[model samples]
Target: MRARLTLGFFTITLAAVALVSVAVLPGLQSRLIDAKLADLAELARQYAPELRKAVGTSLPQSELQDLVGRTADLTGSRVSVLLVVTSDGEITVEAGTDSATERDITLDFSVAIEAATSGRVSRGTEAGPNGQVGEVAVPFLFRNPESGRRRVGRVAVFSSPLRDVEASVAVVRDRTLVAGSAASLLALLAGFLVARRLTRRLEAVQAGAGRVAGGDFSARFPVDREDEIGELARTLDNMRRQLAELDSARKRFIATASHELRTPIFSLGGFLELLADEELDPQTRQEFLRHVRAQVDRLSRLAVDLLDLSKLEAGSLELRPESTDVAELARRVAHEFHPALAAHDSHLEVRVPEDVVEVDCDPERVAQVMRILIDNAITHTPSGTDMVVSASRRGDAVRFGVGDFGPGIRRAMLPHIFEPFITSDDAQGSGLGLAIAHELAERMAGELLVESQPGRTTFTLQLPARPTPPRPAAPPVVTEA
Candidate 1:
């Protein structure tokens, strides 16, 4: 990753440098050439007037040499080539530091013809005998004062070699190479540091995941940035905590479920052994058989509870919700549990008001929830304890509650009451009734909540009320019209 990141940064930097060089080099060269041509044109302006006074005739050789020498001195171009040519493209006068040498260089023959005929200054780059050069030509015009007419009698051509511009460009190329190298080095160093920082954080997360996979839920990622890496670290830490909690829950659940199932199975085995005794009377055998049947029923109910809890966990618990009176459901479940209350030597009380309190819930599921709450209230409390089954309307919900006048559940166990196989130390049942009840209530679009105090414990199922539909408007009377 670090290698890739560094390479990416370096590649981008070099690409930018290349693009700037390609875009700016030609324009730079052209501007420098234009500047040289402008200087030559200005020099021609200076010498044209003197040449114009000598029009229609050739100047004396000494005077032409002096004029060309003074023009070269004023232009101040160190590497300039100046020439004075006749309209027929003959070089009449030439000036340089080597004025002692004989003149031999020729102007571009076509350019000289154009200037002398057109009577205007023209600038261009041309291939000179020395190298490429920027040159300008100015037509020496003889304008008629009265008729406002002009005639070209001569042309002055000035040329400068392009070595200065090329040398400047070479220097720029060297500097660009040096700067691009420095920039690429800097980008590589920065990219390596950034990638290392990122990968270090990711490695922490990877190690944490491995630990969790190995059943060590305590591992956590610790990155404190404000970027995506930090968000991932926080998410991993949260997942670790949740996994730890779920791990604890699963361990406790397995232990509790095994204990619950084993006790009933062991009891059934003992009852069968007693029934198999050869000298046992018919009454004794029948009693033992009844005990075995009771244990079998316990096992059956536990199995059903397990299946329902699994379905709830899998998010496939089905329900058929309808508008039904919550009060009626509570009363029916209370009456149905009266026999069980009698068997346990407990009393049942119904406190539901039949005021048409309606809720959107599955009637059968709601009844199952009520039965679970009532059974818990009766079985968990002492014999002869009075249990009340009640229903009431509060705002937008109808609440059915089962209350017992017995020792309440421990505070530590209250929060986990709806969790499967979670129970108090004093709990004797399968420890699955409330979990199943909670699931059924939720599947029916209701919530199960519990409140417990010393000597009073109440579990309530709160279901949303069905909205009352508005009545239809009365028909208008025709006689009124």
Candidate 2:
């Protein structure tokens, strides 16, 4: 991962450099070429009139050759002079650079002669034996300016192609290479530093995780940074702490289970031993047996609740969802709780709509949730306290709730009431009961919502109503062709 990240950074940096260099270097070279061409053109314009005068009116070929040679020497170029043909399709190369020159220099005398006669300037590039070359031609007319008719002699100024453009481009390429090398060195140093810092922090986290995995639950993470790595470190630390807490809970559960189980076992063993005795009071034996049975029942219930919680946590609990009348389900579960309510001197009052309020849910699980809620209500509310199981339709959902007029759950404990092994002062049962109920409700695509205050608390199970399918649209009629 680190290598890939470094490579990605380098790739982006290089790409940016290449893009900028591609756009800027060619443009700079082109401008330099134009500037050099302009300078050469200006030089030609400066020498045009002087060259025309030196090669004046029908000059001999020898004098023209001498003049061209002197001009080439002064301009530091292989120069050429051509005479324009009047009403003819040929140029007379009167004098210029050596014709047998091995440098393969051929001046474009035709274009130059044409420009001179037509009174215009033109420029072009051409190939010679040596290589590519540039030429500029200016037209010269020695006509009588006052006469409407014309008769003329022509001379053109010429030089070799400019070399400054190539030189400038070479300099630019060297500079770019130097700059790119320096940037790459700097990027390498920066990437190394960043990667080192990140790896160090991650190593620390990995070491902490190793300690936790090896059963050292006391490992904690550094809380120095506020970035994502820091958040990960903090989460790891939290997991360690939770594991420590769970370890302590496991020890407590073991001790509690042993004690609870041992008491019942001792009672049953003692009662059976007494019953086996040949001499014992009948009434005393019956009392001991009854107490043993009650303890056994309590232990059995505790074991059953623990098993149910395990099923819920492992996601192995199955739910069969179907449409059921909410009011009737609530009534049946409430009736089952009559004995427990009477024991607590509490009365169960049901407030369900007479109209069929159907809801999509697993009827058995819904009934179990209702039973748990009613049992919790009966246990928490003191004698003469009133409890109600009600059902109502709210929008597209049906809500079945159990409410009690008792000292409601404490505000602080409300959040975790549905969590496994969580219980409140006002409610005491197998703490798994409400947790299981909540899990069941959720498994049926429903939610268990709670509301509590000083004198009243309500637990509502909300489930979605069976959907009504939309009617099909009619097909449009087609016209005959």
Top model number, lDDT: 1
Model 2 earns a TM-score of 0.74
Worst 10 residues of 1 by lDDT: 472-481
Q: Estimated TM-score per prediction?
A: 0.80, 0.74
Off by over 4 Å in 2: 1-27, 45-56, 60-78, 82-134, 138-157, 160-163, 209-278, 425-428, 466-481
lDDT of 1 by residue, 303-328 (tens): 99988888987989888877788766
| Candidate 2 residue lDDT tens string, 1-481 | 5665566667767776797689988898778756655665776787656776765567777776777677667666555655555557554444442322545544455556656556677655555555435566666566566886554455464656545565677788787878877777777667777777888899899999999999888888896799999999989999999998888767765665566567678878877888788677888878877887887787797788777777887899887878898877877787777677767777677777666767778899889888888877777777788887887776788888888999899899998888765678634355768888888888778899999998999999988887544334333222110
In model 1, how large is the Cα lDDT of residue 50? 64
Best by TM-score: 1
lDDT of each: 0.74, 0.72
Whole-model lDDT, candidate 1?
A: 0.74
